[model samples]
Target: MMSDVFLRIENLRKEFGATPVVNGLDLDIKQGEFVSLLGASGCGKTTTLQMIAGFEKPTSGRIWLNGKDITDVPPSKREIGIVFQNYALFPHMTVEENILFGLVLRKVDKAAQRKRLSELLDLVHLVGLEARYPRELSGGQQQRVAIARALAIKPNVLLLDEPFSNLDARLRADMQNEVKRLQIETGITTILVTHDQAEAMALSDRLAIMHKGVALQVDTPQATYDHPASRYVGNFLGNINILQADLRDVGSHVSFSANGKSLQVLNDQRLSPERCCISIRPERVRIQPQPTDCEVLLGATVTSKNYNGNSWDIGTETELGSVNINIPHHGAPTPDRGQSIVVGWNLNDMRLVHVD
Candidate 1:
C-alpha cells in the first residue's frame, strides 16, 4: 500500500567527533510539499540533508521513505535525487552528456534515454543547448542542467543544497522562481537547505528553522516570522528589537513596564510577573513626534537611517536600548540624527518571551 507520508525522519541524530551536528531531529514531509531546512553554517541543516540522502550515516534514528525504513541504505541504492550548490557538472561534457550521464550509468535503454533527455531539456528551458559545454553556458544555465540531471532519474524525493548560492543576485531570484515553478509542475517532494530567510520564505510551503543542531520552529513562513517560539528564532528570521521588561500588577489585563514606560498585554497565558523579553519586529514600530496614550511609548534619539527603495530602515537609540524600525518610503517621517522621537507600538504587536 502507498504510504500517506512521503518521507519521515524519526529522531535523526549525527555527530562529528565531540560536536553533535544533528541532535534528535524529526521531520515529516508529505508528498509534493516543498520544505526548506533553513539555518546558519554548522547548524546541521546540510548534515540532516546528507543523512537523508544516505551520504552520511546517522549516529542514530530511523529514516522512512514511503513507509519503508531506509536509514541503513547506501547513497547509490537510495533512489533519491540531489543537486548541490556547486552545480557539479562535468566541464568536459556537453549539457546533453551531463544530463544523460546518470541514465547511461544505470544502463537505461538508448531510446528511453533520448526521450528523457529531450523532455528534461524542454522542462529546464534549454531545449537546444544540448551541444553547449558547461563552460559555454551561464551560471544559471549550468545550474538548470544540474537540476535537470538530478531529475532525470525520476527520484521520489529531490534534495537541493544551497542550489542557487553560486548564482548572481538577479540570477538567484530568477532561479528561485524557476525552481518553484518546476517543483509545482513536476510535483516533486523537495527539501531545500538554505540559510537565506527570504529564499525560504519565497519557496517553502513550510520551513524548518534550525539553530545549533536543533529545530527551533517548523511552520509556514508567515507563522514562523510572526510567532517565533524563542528569542533565537525571533532574531534569526528578521530584524527584531528585544526589550527587557518587568510585568506590572494590573487589575484585569497584564502590563509590562520597561524603562519607565508601561505596555499592556493582550495575552495573559505567556505573561509572567518575573522579568521577560519582549520582541517587536521593526515593521511593527511606529515613530511619532509625540507619545500616544494607548500605545507603548518610549523616547528615542535617531541614530541612523537607510533608504532601500521601497522601505526606510530607521535606527533609534532609546533609553532601553538601540532599536531598528522599518517604515514605508512613500510617506515616512524623516527623523534627523540626534533628534528625539517617540517610538510606539500596540499591545497586540508585542510578544512576551521567556528570558533565556
Candidate 2:
C-alpha cells in the first residue's frame, strides 16, 4: 500500500562552475513507491541520484525523508542502499565478507550477523556460493551479490543506478525480474535512474521523465505513455506521429484538421492555440482495406511493411499526413506494400500534446 508522503524533494538545484545541472526540481515519493528518474544522457538524472545519495551537495534546496531533512546528512548515516551500474563489488573479498562489511562496521553481534548473512544469501539465491570471490561469479551473479550486499543492512530506501546496463538482453530481463521481486518482498521504497525507456517502464511504479535537469512529466508508466504532457515526452516515450493541424472550436468539442481531413474530439480545455499539432501513436491507428461507413481517420497507401514478430510496422503516406501504423498479427491478414488502406482510431486516443 503506497500511502503518505515518505520522501519529498523541495526546490532542488545544483550547479558546477556556473553551469546548472539540476534546477528547481520538486518531487514527492510515497512510502513503498518505486520511482524512476528517466532521461537522456546529460539530462542530470545521475546528478540527481547523487544528490539524493548524499554524495553531491545541492547548490540550493532541501531533501526530506521519513519526516526529517537529510540534505546535509552524511552518506554513512543516511541508511540508503545503492546498487551501482557497474555492480561495484570488492575484488578480493568473498561474497559473504562483502555482504558482511556493513554489519561488521556497525558491530552487530556475531549470531545476528550470521543469521542476516544466511537470510541474504537465501534471498538473492546465492546460498551455496557465499564463499566465492567476485571474479569467480558471472555478471548476473555479481549483480545478485551486489544486491545482497546493499540489502544486508535493511535500508530505509534503495537506489538503483542503471543496474542492468552491463547485462545481456536475457540476463537483463532476468535481473529486472529479480529486482522487482526483491523490492516487493523487502518493501523498501525504491528509486531508479536510467536512460532506457523500456527499463524505466518495466521497473517503476511511476517514472519522472527529466530533461535538462527538470522533470517534464511524472506519472504512471502507462498513463504517461498514453497522455504525454508534451510532444517531446510523447516522442521520447515511444514512436508518435506528429501531424500538423489547425484547431477549430466546435461548442464543447474541438475539430482538428490536417490537409482538409478532420476529426473531432472532446476538448480537453488545456489546448488553446489556434494552430497546433496532433500526436497519434502507431498502435492507435487500425489499418484495414475497408473501414465501415462511420468514419475513417485517414486514407493512405502502404509504402513499406515489416513483420516484427507480434506486429507489422507499416509505413504509409496518408492524405492526412505520413504516419506509421503498428498492426498486431493476431490472425489479421497482412497488408502488402502499395496496398490502399484506411486507418481508423477512437477519438479518445488522440491526446492533445503541447509543443515544446
Candidate 3:
C-alpha cells in the first residue's frame, strides 16, 4: 500500500540562467512526515527549500499539496510557514507581539488570537517570558518564539531553513529535540533543510541527499547511511574508506584482489559496474592481534593514534594503501605508534561502489 503523500514535488527544476540549482528533483512527503533536504553547501538544498516556500519560483516543475497544484501560488497565499536562518523576529516586538504577528496580519479575532497565543507560549515553554523582547531572551528562547510565530498561522506545512545554525552546539541539540517534540505534539508536516549530517540523521523520517543539483538518494536515515545508493551519497553522509580493488564477479558474491590478496564482497543487488571501487567504513575495520578463521586479514603498521573520547581513531599503513579504523576505548589495550597489527574485516563489511 502507498502512503498518502501530503506534498509532492515532481520534476522540480530551477536554474539561475544557465546554471542549474535544482535539477529535475522529485520527492514525495507523506502526511505529517518530517523530511529533510540534506547536502553540503551550494548543493541546491537551500534553493529547493526556497522554491517550496514560494520565495523562488522554479523554472519548471509542479508542486502538489494535498492533491492541489501549488506550483504558481504566491508565497503569502501558499499557506506554508517558513522560518529562516535568521529567525527574522521583529526586534522591537515583545515575544507575545512577535508570536501574534501572523494572527494580526490575518485579522484573527482578539479572543481566538489570545487563546492561540497562550497555547503557543505553553507549547514552546515561554509562558512567563512572553513580555520579553528578542534582545532580552536567550538564543533558544528566540528560536522558540520564531517557531511559535510560524505556527501561529496554523499553516499546512512548516519549512525550517537551517533554523539552528546560529546556536552553540549544546543549544543546537536542545533546539533540535525541542522542534522534534513540537512536531510530534502538533502532528504538523515539516521540512527541514540543513547541512548537518547528524541533525538530519537524528530528526528526519527520511532524507533526500542532494548533490550538485540533484538528489542522489532518498530513504530512511539508517538505510541510506548503511546502504548508500552511490559513492557521492556515501561520502557526503560521513566518513568512508575508498580503496582500489581488482574485482571478479562471482555468482552470489564478488571476489576482489586487494594488496595482492583475495577478498570477497556480497553481491546482493547483482551490481555489474564497468568501473568500480571498494568502500569500507572505518568503524567496521577491526584491529586483530591474531587473524581469525572467518576474517580477511591485512598487515598494517599503526602510524598514528588519537583518543577521541569514546573511541581511539587509528591510522595504519597497509600494503594496499592507508586505512583508518576506530577502536572503542572500553578500557581495552590499543596499538601504539610504530606497532604492527593485523586489521581484519568480514565480507559483510565491504561495499562496492561505482568509480566516481
Q: For model 2, what is the alpha-carbon lDDT of residue 50?
A: 93
Summed backbone clashes in each candidate are 0, 0, 0
Model 3 C-alpha lDDT versus the unseen true structure: 0.89
Better of 2 and 3 by TM-score: 3
Candidate number achieving the greatest lDDT relative to the actual structure: 3
Candidate 2: where are CA atoms >4 Å away? 1-3, 250-252, 258-262, 274-276, 331-333
Residue 101, model 3, lDDT: 95
Most TM-score-accurate candidate: 3
> Per-residue lDDT of 97-194 in model 3, one digit per residue for the tens?
99999899999999999999999999999999999999999999999999999999999999999999999999999999999999999999999999
Error of 3 at 351 (Å): 1.5
Residue 72, candidate 1: how far off, in angstroms? 0.7
Better of 1 and 2 by TM-score: 2
Ranking by TM-score: 3, 2, 1
**Candidates 2 and 3 compared by lDDT, better number:** 3
